[model samples]
Target: MNRRELREQIFMLLFRVEFNQKDDMPEQCTLFLEDGDTEISEKDAAYIRSKYEKIAEKLPEIDKLINETAIGWDTQRMGKVELTIIRLAVYEIRFDETVPTGVAINEAVELAKKFGQEGSSGFVNGILAKFA
Candidate 1:
């Protein structure tokens, strides 16, 4: 899988985090990889899983940055799609040195356009711009 595909997988896994209990994430991650219609190579699967784990480990700090930068909007109040996109973008922007800040922001906006609600791209772009 390409980087974009890996990012989408990571975002999907992160979205699952919002719904599942922490204890279930390992199983959920396994099932996600195993049950997919499209097969992912072991190398790509490992990359996705590792990146997801790292981002999840830093979620508290990520959310804190969102809370601090988002002004009046609380993290809980944000749409799940938008919040998930933000989390992914934030992870790339702050933690992953391999992804450029501009590329991260642009890819995040693209993901928002693809997966988020109406106006979600703009909303996500605005929030991520703070970090950029």
Candidate 2:
């Protein structure tokens, strides 16, 4: 799979982590890859697994930035899915400098559009734009 597809997979994996709250990341990451029958290359799966694993390692800092930058919304009040999107987006913006801020924002917006409520994309776009 390409970058966009891989990112989508990462998003889903990260979202599952939030739901499951199991901390064994290597096992969880492997489970995610194994469960998906999509034709992602092993290399792409490895990249996503590493990124997602790193994101989990720094979740406290990631959530702190997300809560601070989320304007009027508390991270607690946000839907679990939206919160996960913001966390992943903020993690990308802060930790992965290789990804342009705009690309990170756009990717988050797209994920919101696909998985969030009607206005969630706009909301996510606005918050991530602040980082850019």
Candidate 3:
């Protein structure tokens, strides 16, 4: 899968975090991979899992950044979809060196448009714009 596809997959996987307990993530991730609409190759699956894990690992710091940057919007009070997208973008922008900042913000907005409420894209763009 391409980077965008991978990001989408990661986003979907990460979305589960808001709904499940920390201990449940391993099973959740495995079930998510097994139940995907399209069959994923072992290599892509591994990549997705690793990247998801890395993102999950950094979520505390990511959420911190979000809390700091988006005034009046803590992770708890934010919409689940927007919070999830912001978490991924924050990780990419602040942690992942390979992803250009523009690409991270743009892809996150795309994800927001695809999975979030009608105004999600703009909300995501507005929040992300504060980062760079």
RMSD, one per candidate, in order? 0.7, 1.4, 0.8
Q: Which residue runs does candidate 3 get wrong by more than 4 Å?
A: none
- lDDT per residue for candidate 3 within 1-132, as digits (tens), equals 898998999999999999999999999999989887978888989988999999999988889889999987888899999999999998899888999999999999999999999999999999999997
TM per candidate? 0.98, 0.92, 0.97
Q: What lDDT tens digits, residue by residue, belong to model 2 across residues 43-87? A: 888898888988998888988887788778878898877888888
Per-residue lDDT of model 1, residues 18-132, tens digit only? 8999999999999998897669899998998899999999999999999999988879999999999999999999999999999999999999999988899999999999998
C-alpha lDDT score of every prediction, in listed order = 0.92, 0.84, 0.92
- Residue 32, candidate 3: alpha-carbon lDDT: 89
The alpha-carbon root-mean-square deviation between model 1 and the true structure, to one decimal in Å, is: 0.7
Candidate 2 RMSD computed on C-alpha atoms after optimal superposition onto the true structure: 1.4
Candidate 1 has its poorest 10 consecutive residues by lDDT at 32-41
Model 2's TM-score against the true structure: 0.92
